[model samples]
Target: MNSHLPTEKQQKLKQLIVIFCILLITLLFAFTLLIAEPTQELSSFELDQQGQKVGSGPTEFRIHNQQLYVAVPSNGHYVIPEADLKTIRMLSDDIATRQIAVDQKHVYCGNMILKNLNPQTVRSIGDGYISDGQVSYYCSQITERNTELNVVQEVWQILLHHTGIGSKPQSYWYPHYQLETSQSPYQLTVQGTVSNGEYTYFRGKLVEQANGHTMRYLPSYSGSSDRLRESSHYTADGTHVYYKNQRVPVQDHPQLMVFDFGGGIESEFLHDRKTQNFYYQTSPFSQKYSPYHLLNKDDEHAHDPLFLSQQGIYFYHRQEQKLQRTGDNPFSQKLTQLAPDVFHNGQDTYYLGLYDKYIRSGRGTKLCYRSTVLYRLKNAPVNRWQKIAEVKYGNSRWRAATIWKNGAQYYYFDEFGQGQGFDQAVYLIKDAYALRFILNPSRSSDDIRQYAGRGILLSPQVERLAKAKYDENFCVSELWSQNE
Candidate 1:
């Protein structure tokens, strides 16, 4: 073997090297093409199960059973079932009334009588039915009740039907029954008198089996005072008699007084049924310095002292309690100052509404509002706060606030500034769980929009939309998907 290669061998080696280089370049180009393609790209259109191209938008798109549905802003609703193109027939120009209901047996639609006849024909009822619209169908006398019709009118009532034997009225009517219970099996005779006064002893039989009974007592005092008072007692089936201005906490004692707190009850007297711990407020009538001065700077009165957790009874006291001096008063406290309207969601989490601002708390952590922000508390002990959303309050003003569901959802009412005050509209953002809002737009300048909207929870089965990662600065407009 010679150290130097021949000319022919060198040429062959050069050709092989060129071929290997070309192959390597081809593989590299193919790999680059795969990586360059965007993983998150906006789909132009989608196809149905029947290969039909559905329209596209930001919303999550899906096709089920060859049908296409779209999600959009329909009267404040984000998602709606798409109308069937085949069943879009105009049966009649005149609109017909239809009633809808669902039961274990079948889904009912159309008029009450017609729905009863053919209960199974009802399909998915759309939201459009709520508007002034019409539906049509062929009439059929499915039962004998349809053939016979009679109408009558009575004073203070309108009788819609009368069939010689019975009658039906437009308004509701409850039948009354008065049965003599003296002859019944369950009967008892008892005699009793008041301990304080020597009142007259009346003889009366207690009917145990009767549905109910009313007793009218006219106790005439023979003494000097000219004042006369009459008290009547009503017993249901000779048991559980309710007396005026008195409540019986337990049964078997007809004459007993239950615990009653007179006027000035504390504001934080919350009854925790789950833990059986009764949280209440104590009166500040005896204390020289008002609790108001300790908690609130304003002249407003602090009626009741609230007990927080296992900590001793907390009141706005200047010298007695160290927590109060440490700015733990209800008004001056940083937590309450950040959120005046506090809502505890029966769990560790709490929603705070500090004047116009909003915040959330849990364990030992607190988070405040900056813009349209959402905050969540970190896990216990070493609790911390985290930001969720910087949503924009599009066309609404803050009204009231509420925290519910162990801090799962923080809801707030937004005054739509429609001159209707607090009843104008409500805006709700489902924190990081689901980004959504409920809007009730006013019909006119003077009309008020009350509870007329609901936030929708996007489910995969119902709406196969792409899930977005939690973004603290996401807006309502950004969360809304219009695809499919």
Candidate 2:
């Protein structure tokens, strides 16, 4: 009835609005396609209640692929070629125990049951490594690490009870032919081997042949109380020096000579009764390594074990499994050790600038030359030493610059004159304060408060240097200034 009324006008407007909205939606959809980014396929897997994936990376000892291979548990392990991956879960939550584990045959990783390997007890050794009662696993592959001295001894005992060294002991179920592994849990070797009832294990690995009857530990020094120090362990059977069961080959070693361990200048040393070629840790030094009481053997250095080779004082260092020259400054001429590390040429004390660890002699920095030293004693380099003050009195003159170690602390003073004699001598207490004396030199010992560091005292500064005889780089006088 109202078809021809004004309501028809409203209907016409509504139709136009709907058509305009459809066009706007179409434009936005096309614009979105133009700027859309490409997306990569997402990695998907089921996780346990603890939020750990049952099989993900090598950490789980399970590889993920398009084919769903599942690990199933039993008295022994089984790898199912076709199974739902979402049903599996890792066993433990601790990241350390994230590797595949089995309880008798209930193989587990997070919440997933693994293909059973008849695991007794699985232990993780960090970095995706796992070891079970039967074998060790690494990166989902068989591997071994080096064994420690103590662990080698312990593992050998387990082998001895299970199998005979040359032959398997009478057993009910199976004859043991197992191999041992090292600490790496991956490197298994049978070299220089030893055996137990189960397998011929070096430490944790099974070897083809080794001395089965002899004990694996080092014999105590005839006079010592303990067996041996942990870091410095050495044992020998007939052919090699074994440090934690790792072979250290020796050349020119006599069969009849007895091996005796001695104190190294820095660490424990190895000595043979018949020869002077001593070993520090696993390293062997030259034959020139003289005896402790050999006074005539001045050719060898006792400290750091330096020796004369090709007319140069070469230090013996075993780096990368080889001995080579490695001294900051090997002396050019033949010198005698008058003190511990202090060498003497005629009456002169060889100056080893700051590189020389020994500075108590005052040779390099005790006004001996003209420079305060740091690091190991070395010859004072040019420009390293600068003159900061100068004073001349009668036949004696003194100069002061820089600071050198007095004892535990460092101080600056004059070599010729007393520091107290200066118009306004400034003594700095802390290392940060004395740094200014090196950067800036004042002719008249006066303190600028801005530059004067904490613990500044003028009078005691001079007296301390004079009494302690802290030297200047270049001074005509050896004694402290009398003006104090």
Candidate 3:
């Protein structure tokens, strides 16, 4: 400006510098604003006393209040403060009592005895309310007597008396009492006696006595061989007994008789040696065939006959050779398709087998194998479908595996693999799909091999599911019943 340069050039340079500075300041301010903006908003119901964000969305009641504020959604109340908040104390005494009362009112009370004859012997009493005026009273009288041999024989004369002003007394008494006596070195006799006031019920002095004979003392035979003679094979349910492809009668031998799909047909076979009749009951022909018995003649033929889920009875017409579905029988209902083997997770989800079609290529020709697939049922319509495994080979192959919901994951082999694999290694499925390959040595080893595995295995998620199902106790028999 002082004769160093022209006025217009200096002015132009100054103007350019001013414009660049203004542009830089503007960009810096914009960047600062972007960084200052919060990623998530504070919950509507929760707030910090210092007007700072504590938690995202509506804050839930929390144990810590030094850094985060907690809001209880139920009553729209703040449970914790941002700072200076002590213990959460989620539930008060009154709240706990109210919750317990609600649960008692709505939940089912199993096997509850309103008027128990003897509370001393009652191991468990369900939750229920008793009126203040109601009272249960039991009294028994004992008479003492001495025998000539000076063996003090005390006569027990129990008299139970109850007083419930307007209620009937509920009593369960052992009317016929028997005393065990030593007969000899090889035998013991149970002497049966009736109460003094009661009428004599025995047919003879030594009525219904079993001597310790070699044959009588011998363990009772299960008649399994007899069962085999009647029918080489039996259905999953014991109900339908069969002998040599014919129906059998199970009236006299109920133990030998099994419940075939709901009393369809009974057949009998005679054994020459024992003259013991073997019986078999054929499952009723239904539109829905048993999934467990998918390898059966009708099932192999893809007849699509209906069968009872619990009973395993099939439904088919002999003349038409066509399968029929009818609700007339108590066992099954009319349906296009039956539900797959179902296993519950103790929540809204249920693991089920779904029918799927797979193509197998043999000698340049392709054949379709109509098999079952696994699916997870959720609360929504679009339930998750989890492809667990498939039966690639073998006739009358694996049906569906049974899941054990305990502290850890366990699965039972399908009907085909039953009594085949090692007890420990025989588990059908695992929660982790990868473990299936590790357990099955026959399968090839590769990264993709993990996907080829089948059956249940131990896993943290599976353990959680098991704990949920068996919060109290679980049963192995019930799990095996699924195969039956």
Candidate 4:
């Protein structure tokens, strides 16, 4: 029995040794497999609309809301749609599509793939504006293909100037509805006025010699007019001065003052207090006129350019070289040319003027008044001036009439309405959509009768002028908005 027990124990030991060797061999093989190749779970994308998998080989796809978004190598150039496997859109074959940027309405083709932009660094600034650091892309609303507006170049940095009071003014660049949303909370109205550190741009055209660092808006008494193209805006840098991007020359910046007669007539006349020089449309008048001495020097009306004196009435206008004389002063008191050709005589007001209506093709819209000029005559009788109608509203009363006459022909007031007190030229309620009309005084017709009755007349000439093809500069000038 002892011999049998020893033999069994030896067999058991041999069996244990064999089992240990097998286990060691298995562990060694597993360690070798782990070191040779690492295990990672790779993502896979579905087929595109064309039934072909997009992007180059070994590409990893990103799935967002069941949509397949993939970042491909520089050599891959296809955009895939996950909703429908057969709706693939192919970019230019030569383009190396790099990245995919997904917005609600657009999936961007990395920068270099379209319009020579760099995809690696493309980013959105604000208000549908995107940039690759150098070039700008201005999208009106959605940022889809064929909807981008390439603005300027060499834009490493963008500076938005807010003309509004609170945080900033609302941006006119984007749609009005998106202005206050969380996505776009900045109040910034570019209005074709933007600046970098080196240059200032208006409507994408650079203002030459204007320092962008110092460029700021020159605010008028009535803010900005609704006319985007022809508003009376000014900006100045360290040494240069610009009025709506046009250079304005003045000896001293402090001495230059803008004298506007209200009613859309803004920055038309500039006066230099240091030199006593008057500028019309930024051009110096040939002569200067000094104020006349009055019994009451303290009276504000006595300091006007046109004041009554013992030597008759002296008038100043852009058409004359000197202060033109208006014969003898008929009125006993000092006369103030309240509204261009309209004058007040303390008790009754009189207008002795002529009509010269001009239109700027595409500029009369909401918040912007009409454009017209009224020229006052030298020697005219006050008795011929007659009233046509009276407009009364909100504790205000205004009289409209034919303030001048040539003979049997009576020239009546056309547009007579609100201004500081009242503008004898522009009617606040009338919208003329850039049309022209003429009244023939020689022929006593319906036009003249309408002119005499309601001070409003329409002619077929309006349609003709509207159809007439005029250049962008047809009636464009610094004096373009002459609503006297």
lDDT of 3 at 391: 26
Task: List model 1 lDDT by residue over 432-461, tens digit each.
Answer: 433333333322323323322323321111
Candidate number that wins on TM-score, 1 or 4: 4
lDDT of 2 by residue, 1-484 (tens): 7877678888898999999997786576455545654222113333112223343443333434433222222211223333345443343454444444444445543323444234446554333344554554332222222233256454444344323232111111111122344432332222223433334344333323334344243433321224433332444545455544445546324321222322432234455546544455556565553431211121111222333344233433423333444322323344554222233344333321121122244455343322111112223222233333332322323333334343344334322112233222223336655554444543343332323333442222211110111223444453363332
Number of the predicted model whose TM-score against the real structure is largest: 4
How many clashes (backbone N, Cα, C below 3 Å) per candidate?
Answer: 14, 54, 41, 14
Report the lDDT tens digits of candidate 3 across residue range 1-484.
5686688788999999999997886576556545553223245434544344322222222323354333322222222222232321211132111111111112101111223222222111111111112221111111112122221111101111111112111122111112122222111111111111212111112212222121111012121122321222231112322332233333123344222221123212122122222122233333234331221211211222233343433334433444433222222232221112333323333222213222334544332222222233323121232433442222324332323333233343232221232112113345545345433434332221232143233312211111001111233344444221
Off by over 4 Å in 3: 1-113, 121-250, 254-484
Those runs of model 4 whose alpha carbons end farther than 4 Å from true positions after fitting are: 1-115, 118-130, 136-192, 221-231, 259-335, 338-341, 344-391, 394-415, 418-484
Clashes of 1: 14
Candidate closest to the true structure, highest lDDT = 4
Ranking by lDDT: 4, 2, 3, 1
lDDT of 2 at 69: 27
RMSD of each: 28.4, 24.7, 31.2, 29.1
lDDT of 1 at 51: 29
**Over the full model, what C-alpha lDDT does candidate 3 score relative to the true structure?**
0.26
* Candidate 3 lDDT for residue 109: 12
Give the runs in model 1 whose Cα sits over 4 Å from its true position.
1-165, 169-349, 352-484
- Comparing 3 with 4 on lDDT, the higher-scoring candidate is 4
